[model samples]
Target: MVFESRGEKVFRFAILIVLGLLSVIALLPLLSVISVSFSSGWVVDLNQVTIWPKAFTFDSWQYMIDRPDLWRSFFLTLITTLIGTLLALLVTAMLAYPLAKKEFMIGGILMVGVVITMVFKAPIVPYFLTVRSIGLYDNPLVLIVPHILNPFNLIIMRTFFKQFPKELEEAAFMEGSGYFRLLFSFVLPLSKAVLATLALFYGVVLWNQFQHPLFFITDTDWYPLQIKIRQFITDPNEMPFLASRQEVNYNERTLRSATVVFAIIPVILVYPFLQKYFVKGAMIGSVKG
Candidate 1:
């Protein structure tokens, strides 16, 4: 094999160094959160905790578990992530399929409008008013309804569909398969990679959604985990702890870190399963057409 040039080797080394630094930077905060969450109240207060716990304790996590309201909010977030992801994938795929075909009338105009919306988002007041007018305010549907179609995700999926093999559609048509049959039976089965990717995207968005619930959902019972965590961070005194204990004293930092880790765990758990599909889906969906 030929020896690499000095410049090429230096460039490769630099790229590796940059990527390693980025990885560390991304992971540092998460590690700090977990470490701080586990550390003793005083340790956290002193800001000693970093990559590892200084005086290890589980008081904050225990306190978090003791709160029923936090659990309820977690369940609400879970429900929204699951249902919202599924609905978004289905709706986005449906919208993208027809738009992928050039023969579809109004496809170009609709795409232009979608791009415009993406570039210039609507004002929050109008968005809230529209949601209110539709009776979604204070409803659980507030989390699921307004966020079903993401324009960026839609465009990515449209590109994926546009690059799909036309021969398959032609063969299906020749076999007398209808549009729904062709879509649901054949297209969807072949589109699993993109579907999984978009599902993850939607799931993360729904799970991390704070502003929508903050505005539309007034009832404390309907608050998602993020909103609950926001309240905790904003004012730890308002935390609805179950029972008082003298041995374990938790401060806002401890509570915030625990809530943050709790909220993050689900998405972390989910990413691994979909990791295999992510790169392929993103590349195919975004680069083609």
Candidate 2:
């Protein structure tokens, strides 16, 4: 390594210190949430609110585990995330692939349409009315269908596909391979990084979706985990033993923290595997013409 001047060394050290501080600041909230979740009760004393847990307890986790409704909601969330991400990927790929081609006459028009849709979101009431009219109001389709092809994701995928080497497509065409065959055999395999990135994006969105289910789904059985957590936090009266002073006051704060911890665990678990792909994909997808 080249020797650094004193000034350069000082500058580099300053930058490193700033970055370290920023990282800790960013991580503080997550660490606090985890601490609260594992804390014995909701009203953690001010003295105990440190980086490390004052006293550890699994009561929050135990409480959540014993709730059948929470489990059901979690299952619903998983199903919705899986189905929504897969569908979103398919629809995004289909729309993006043709748009990626310069030869496609209507590609520009379609792209403009997508941009317009992204810019001007329809009012909630009218959208809800339309969903009800289409008879998808209570179904899981209500959540998945509305977001099947996110415009930003479409744009990213289109950009990624456009970056593919023209020579590859030309060679495939020379071999008499059709568009679908080329897409299936060559384009898709090469685009896995971008696809994985989009999948994670869509999956996270689906998993965290709360408003759609809150409005469209009336049945308690169909509520997603987020909705369930919201209900628990907001409507403490609905929870058993909360009305009596003889029982331990369920710490809503602690419960909320636990719920958040549980909610994020699935995404956290899968992120490391796909993180490499995410960065590569984002770089490829953000390239402008």
Candidate 3:
């Protein structure tokens, strides 16, 4: 029988305590936001703020659902996220696979170019001008085209591809499997974990994108959820309900919290389904090659 040392037991207990404290601290803000969102009144009393709500209400959520413009923006965000993520994953895999091959004639030079582009971001104004010149400005493609080939995602995918067993590629070549067939049939199937991670990342970025729509897209009907939230917060007069209630009540804090809660709901709903793939994908993609 083996006996545990007193010092080792004390060290383990200290580590557990630190981890527990950190977890509580991280969860506190999210818990507070949720509590405030469900509170009954229009005003949140800062002095009376607590983790548990004093009075409960679903009025804010109901109000959000009643607004047609908000629902339209939500759908726009969803469509954009799906389209952009798909395009990004497809383009990234196409570019990364070739770069991952050592036998490719220009692999070294191409890799260097990719690294340099990642290091030196192009000026936003010039890029915007180029997009306008190409007739993509203010178009749905505008959201996707500029970010389709993210260098960081490409690098991670290339590293993952490089880690694939070389013998598999050789056997596929001997079986007369063309690159396209091999890529779709074999490579992609095995790379699901990393691909799922990148898709989630790209989707989230596209869903939360505000600056692009604010600058390039002028049409109010084409605005995404984030831009809508910004507009609501900035110009309450533009919101019909708020404008109607302007004389009686004007509580900015409660409105802000409501908007935040609405914006976060989609992300929260998405995380649970994709979480298992996310951690594994990130670990495999980042820690390898």
Q: Which residues of candidate 3, in runs, are more than 4 Å off?
A: 1-16, 239-251
Looking at candidate 3, the ten consecutive residues that score lowest on lDDT are 246-255
lDDT order of candidates, best first?
1, 2, 3
- lDDT of candidate 3 over 1-289, digit per residue (tens): 8777999989989999999999999988887777776675544654354666545666666666778998888888888788889989999999889888887899889888988998898898997788789987677667667767888888889988999898998899999998888888899999988898898888888988877887688788888889998888789675446546644332455556677788888888988888888898888778866
Model 2 per-residue lDDT at 2 = 100
What 10-residue stretch in candidate 1 is worst by lDDT? 240-249
* Whole-model lDDT per candidate: 0.89, 0.85, 0.80
Candidate 3: residue 279 lDDT (0-100): 90
Q: List runs of model 1 lying over 4 Å from the truth.
A: 1-9, 239-245
Candidate ranking under TM-score, highest first, comes to: 1, 2, 3
Cα error of candidate 3 at position 28, Å: 2.0
TM-score (C-alpha, index-matched) for candidate 1: 0.93
- Number of the top lDDT candidate: 1
Query: What's the residue-level lDDT of 155 in candidate 3?
Result: 86
Q: What would the per-residue lDDT of candidate 2 be over residues 21-77, giving only the tens digit for each residue?
A: 999999999999898888766347444655666567777777778888889989989
Residue 150 local lDDT, model 1: 97
TM-score of 3: 0.88
The global Cα lDDT (0 to 1) of model 1 is 0.89
For candidate 1, the clash count comes to 0
